[model samples]
Target: MAMAADKPFTLLDRCPPSFEKTAQGVCKLHTRYDQYDSIQGVGVGGLTSSLPARRDGFTPEQIDLGRYLFFDPLLSVDSTHSCASCHQPDKGLSDGLARSVGVSGEEIPRSAPTLWNTAFLTSFFWDARAKTLEEQMLGPLYDAKEMGNNPVQLLASLNANQQYRSMFKQAYPAASDDITLDQIYTALTAFQTSLISLNSRYDQYAHGYHQALNQREIEGLNIFRSFVARCAECHQPPLFTNQQIAVIGTPEPEGMPLDIGAEKTYNAPKLKGGFKVPTLRNIEKTAPYMHSGRFDNLRDTVEFYTKGRGHAVPEGVEMNLHWHIWEPNLQDHELDLLVDFLKTLTDESFMPPVPKDVPSGLTPITHTVQTTTMINHSNSAPGKGE
Candidate 1:
């Protein structure tokens, strides 16, 4: 079970920046303003048809504070990794690695998923362990292989910092103390929920802008939606996800233990290899696909679905072949068209900028380098599973 599941952190109690406080101290959020002002608009046809219903109260101040916290390395035990370190904006909010390297410089078992359109998701993480974004925010921090910061110590560290204290005060004026774990989670969740990605060539086309997509892209769109490829069955448009978990039979890394993805939380044999269906909104930018990051590029990923590269299932494990709708018999040109359509989902405006400096005075982000010896060793050895 998650640590802070018992805490009360509802959207109504913590109002957004746009909210007006009543004389009786009741909070109400205003949704009248054009929230899409900052990002490019999708015009009409409601391209973001799958956008999850917005929560009532998120303040601009809270978002600002969360942004700082997300980029700050102080949240980590060793102060070497920040949320942005693994979810780099330049790399489409995902580290450009098959598997992520945690604070100890050890490889994490699974791929770091992109933060794009997470507000639409009912659950967070590949395993779907976190039900709310607030819960998800604290997950990596507590994970020993990830940030590895104890919740008590983490709160103490933040409370000691005058800058964070002031920011917290401004974000949550109702709070008696300078900072608390709930407030931290709230602020972080607010910022992450604000990350919406709807501006793309496909979006423009969907919104009645006929000329937005070219001839090939249009053909690709047809192929994606057609039964021949059936790409859109799971990767449905608007948000581009069916919001379900399935075992598509992706091959386990050689020598690694079987990763019982959703089963870790659900403990059901039927869900043994099931993983959450990630949004393909900015799919082109977030490369190294699948739960294991087994496929390196979009072409390979498309081919996997078409040709089914997944290994045979182990005893007692069932593969959800219903979700695997890609027709292996698709012509090569049709496959090219499918790839072209997927690329249309790339939206550059969705990328968040890395902060020049963080509150802790530590570097906001750092690149991990593998020595020649390490690379040679990896080449000679097989991978270990989670």
Candidate 2:
């Protein structure tokens, strides 16, 4: 069972430069979207929506303690895969694999979702199965094909380590002598909430810097929000997701049966093949797209939307595809423009320092993704498409 099944755990990850310590040792996060406060933020294009509730009653020590747990593979049953193993920083907090390989080297059903801005989310997982972030941790931490560790084994390992014992005590200065499962959930929740990303070129344009995006990109943004394409209906901006489940009829890899997404969660037939609309904040880096990682790149992913409604759905499946899925019939360059606009969302400003060593002395599975410099196209006039 997941630790603290009786309680709840909050989430965010890695204290970035935006994090600051108060005189009382509480951590405060400063974000760009602070200006957009109301439920319906009044902003450029009138496309921005209000963010959801976030948790942050955590100390810096707790955030730091969670950081160690995040990168250390000891959280796994056999001391192999760490949380970072699937969600790496370099790749926009995603593994960049079509589907993640579990601790047993077995291929899982879906790709790893990025952890950026997770603090603002009310739902967890592609199917929206878990209500809280702590509940979500149970999926990967103990799934036989995932981290493969149980609560008893997990507590035993952490309690056996003196450094961990000290760290937990420090993180929870008022807690008991030995480490408890609640503390583990708290620390992890603290760190996960710390992972924030809001400073992007699109953010600049959204803030009234018309020059932040070139002419083509601005048009692409228009198309994205346009009723015909209607990309923004679900992937609404500011956060780049409405955080609702949509049955988009995305197909699985060849020869694979349907994964029947949120239907199992709510037990509604109409919800079949539905998944949470993921954040497009750093969509450029987290490729092969979709929950099953069906598409390889942004161009392909965008192309899927234009290929007519339910075009990719396997035959004989009368799925309740989201109404947003339609035949937009966008052109080649339009597809490319959408990709350019998406690339403008890249922001790695909140990356936390990867711990060099953990208390367990286990080699951390630090998934390192190569960083590439994005072209500066801010305020550029309409020109030939790159």
Candidate 3:
């Protein structure tokens, strides 16, 4: 049954009523990073440094309102795609696509990134163009190939609905009667900040459960952090990303022209094909990896890194790759082991339930499970445990 509009949205993790708030309106979060006092070291395996501060602590009303907005197609120029259209609850909060296609069905030039641990990220988007989540939203909200909406039209759409007006008013009691763009951004950010994912088998091991991972997975973890592979150097533990720009020399899909990744954003020559390093927290759930979605699976993607550094770089293109990019000459078995360890990072513990029906009266959602073969962690078959 569809939930009543008046009822507050349900949540599985931290919230205002359960935790005390400071005078600044900030509520302290209980994260896995908080489990360890201060023993975590930067870039070290089996130990993680304190996570960057999160943007949590929104009221239940605001969060519930954001939840409704996130799934409502009313935000798009055409009443077809919602925020949930791209960032689905399934598929690890990422659409299962090589390149995202908007309501117009036009190619969006890059893959939809996973929103798993975005609350902890300082930078947003592949090019590291936006500093805040609100800024990040503007790109998709108005981009012709993305949501394709303008602020004027968006507010008009929200105001047209009586339920939305009431919801927004309740969410922001002291604000004006008129709905504003800032409120929309804040609501979205609030809901997204509540998307916490830190209870995986890997997290269990990180929290000091020796039997959580079998010997094979443990070996894989060792190889992952070892200098030989050095995957952990950029894909740091806890969040699994150093969150910096790097010209990794990833290739564009065949027949597609060069993207010039972060070069346009920074206007620098060295960053000709750089992009923000994404967290590998739910690597198995997101397929067709890289900024351009060049490789199809983990094996092909991992093998590309050791394939003579800039081997995948288009012919005649001179590039300055990140210093970490080097030939590791990893064995096939070792590569498989590394993949095994990555699967242990899967955790949908705090995944919010998709609404049955949104206030906009449009169909709530449609998503496809990724076709890529991967470990089914729920089955609890040995190393790939619950």
lDDT tens digits by residue: candidate 1, 297-386: 888777767674344466566655544543467777877888898899898674555666666666676454332322221332111211
lDDT of each: 0.68, 0.78, 0.76
CA deviation > 4 Å runs, candidate 3: 1-27, 37-43, 366-386
Give the CA lDDT, 0 to 100, for residue 16 in model 2.
46
Over 4 Å off in model 1, which ranges? 1-50, 308-318, 323-328, 366-386
- Per-residue lDDT tens digits for candidate 3, residues 113-169, read 898878788988898888888888888888775778889999988887767777788
The candidate with the higher lDDT, 2 or 3, is 2
List the pairs of residues colliding in candidate 2.
11-193, 12-191, 12-192, 12-193, 13-191, 13-192, 13-193, 13-194, 13-195, 211-379
Sequence-dependent TM-score of model 2: 0.88
Cα TM-score per model: 0.82, 0.88, 0.89
- Candidate with maximal lDDT: 2
**lDDT per residue (tens digit) for residues 1-386 in model 2:** 12212222232333447776777767777665666656642332354455566777678778888898998877989887889988888888888887676665655677889999888888888888887778788788888767889999999988887677777877777889788888888888888998888879888888788889999899889888787788888887778888899999998876456878889889999999999999998888899899878999888899989888898888888899888788889999999989989998988876887876677777667773222423222322111000
